[model samples]
Target: MFKVIAVAGSPRREGNSATLLKAALAGATAAGAQAEVVYLNDLSFRGCQGCQPCTADDTCRVQDELTPVLGRLRQADVWLLGAPIYFDGVSGQMKLFFDRLHHLTNEAGQLRKMLPGRRAAAIVVTYEDKPRDDYREVAQRLANYLGWMGRFDPVEVVSLGRLGPSDAAAARPELLAEARALGQRLVEQLAQQGRTDG
Candidate 1:
C-alpha cells in the first residue's frame, strides 16, 4: 500500500483547514492508500533553531515530539499539507514545521529530497477573504520548495477562502469535494509514476 501523510497546521482542532485535510485523507484512504493525519497543534515541539545540526547528521537535534514525525516523512510516498492563512501566509505552526524540514538536505548543504524516488505532494490553504489569484501563491511557495527537494511535479496546491468563523468545511460541499478530488488525483499521479513502493 502507498503511504500518505496529511498534515493539519490549524490551531483549532476542528477548523476549516483540519476539516479539509481530513476530507483529503478520506479520499486517499478510499483510493487504497494508507493515510495518516498529523496535527501540528497536538505535537509539542519547537521550530528549527538554525543551528544546522542536520548539516552534520541529517537529523534535527532538538529531539522533541516532531522527531518521530520527521522520521515518518522519509518513508511516506506523498505529503498533504493543510493550513489556515495568517497575514497572507501559512500559519505560524505550519511555517515552523516546514522550517524544520531542513533535515531533508545533505551534508553538502543541498537538498537531499527526503523521500525516495519520484514523490508527490499537495498543499492546501484556507483564508477568510475572497479567493484571489495571489492567495494561491502561499501554497505555491511550499509547492516550489517541495519541488526543489526533488518532487519536481507541480504540487496540487489548493486554496479555500471566505469560510465563516464557525463554519466547518463540511458545510461547504464544493470545497470538500475538491479536496477529495485533489487527494484522488495525487494518488493517481503516484500510481502513474509507479512510485507506490510502499
Candidate 2:
C-alpha cells in the first residue's frame, strides 16, 4: 500500500490548516493508502542550526523530535503539507520544518536521495479577505522546492482565504471537500503510475 504523510504546521490543533490536513488524510486512508498526520506544534524541535553537517554526510546533525519526521518523509510516497499564512508566508513552525529539509540536498545542490515520481500537495490558509498573490507564491515556491529536492512532480497547491476565525474553514464544507478530493486524486494517480510501471 502507498504511504502518505500529512504535516500540520498550525499551533491550533483544530485550526483551519489542521482541519484540512485531517480531512486530506481521511481521504487518503479511504483511498487505500496508509496515512499519518504529524502536528508540528505538538513536537518540540529546533530550527536548522546552520551546521552544514548535511553538506558532508547528507544527513541532519541536530537530532530532535523532528528527526523521526524527516525519516518518515523520506519513506512516504506522498507528502501533504498544510500551514496558515503568517506575515505573507507560512507559519514559523512550517518555516522551521522547511529549513530542516536542507538535508535533502548536498553541497553540490544535488538531491541526497532521489524519490522519483513522488507526489506532494501544499495547503495554504489565509485570513486576509483579499488573499494576495504573495500567499500563493509562497505555496508555489514550496511545491517547486519539493519538486527540485525530492523529485516530486505535479505538486498541487490548495489555497484557502478569508478564513478569519479558527472555525471558519469548518463552516465551508466545499473547502473540506476540495481537500479530500485532492487527497484521493493524488493516491489514485500514484496507484495508476505503479500499475503502468509494473
Candidate 3:
C-alpha cells in the first residue's frame, strides 16, 4: 500500500507547481508515508479525441502513459494534483488528464465501478496575484465531480496564487508548511479510516 501518489499537471519540469508538490510529497514522507511523483510532461497522453470508445470496455484502448496512471490512481491513497492556472484554468497538459478521466468511463456518464474510496488533494498555483477565486472554483467543481463518482472528497485544497518559479523557493517557509500540513492531515485521515497507504 503506497502512502501517496502525486501527479504533476505542469508542463515545466521544475515549475512552481511541481516544486510545491515535491515539498508536499516530502512532508508526507516525513510523516512516515511513501510518495511517488508522476509528471505529465514525460507522458505520451493523447488528449481526448471524443471517439467514445472506452465505454465498451470502460477503459481507454489508445494505450499510452495514462494507461498505467489510471491503474495507479485506483490503488493510491492520496492524490496531489498540482497545476498552474492558464487563462483562469489549469494548463492544457493537466486539462487533458482531466479530460481523459472523463473518457475513461461509460456512456451513461457514470464512472466505472473501479473508481471509489480514493482520497485526493488539489494544489492549484497561479501567477495571478490578489487571490483569485478561479482556482478554488475549478478545484471545488473537480472535487464535486470526483465525489459524484464515489471518490472521497479532498480533505483540503491549497491555492497558491501570484507566485513565480523564482519565488517558489522563497515561498517555501509558508507554502511548504501548508503543503506539509496537507500531507500529514491526509495521512492521518486515511490512517484513521484504516487506509495504511496514507
lDDT, candidate 3, at 5: 82
Per-residue error for 79 in candidate 1, Å, reads 0.4
lDDT for 117 (candidate 2)? 51
lDDT by residue (tens digit), candidate 2, 1-198: 888899999998898988888888888888999999999999999999988768766688988999999999888877899898988789999999999988776655555544445555555555545767778888888887786566564478877778879998888899889888878888888877672242
Task: Estimate candidate 3's alpha-carbon lDDT, on a 0 to 1 scale.
Answer: 0.71
Ranked by lDDT, the better of candidates 2 and 3 is 2
Off by over 4 Å in 3: 103-113, 196-198
Backbone clashes, each candidate = 0, 0, 1
Model 2 scores what on Cα lDDT?
A: 0.80
lDDT of 3 at 15: 75
TM-score of predicted structure 2: 0.91
Clashing pairs in 3: 3-197
TM-score of each: 0.92, 0.91, 0.85
Q: Return the clash pairs for model 2, or none.
A: none
lDDT of 3 by residue, 1-198 (tens): 445888888877677788778878887887778898999988998987777767666676667878898788767778788888887788888889878776444545655543555565655555556677776787667666555444564556677766866456346687778777777777766667664232
Stretch of 10 with least lDDT, candidate 2: 108-117
Q: What is the C-alpha lDDT of each candidate?
A: 0.82, 0.80, 0.71
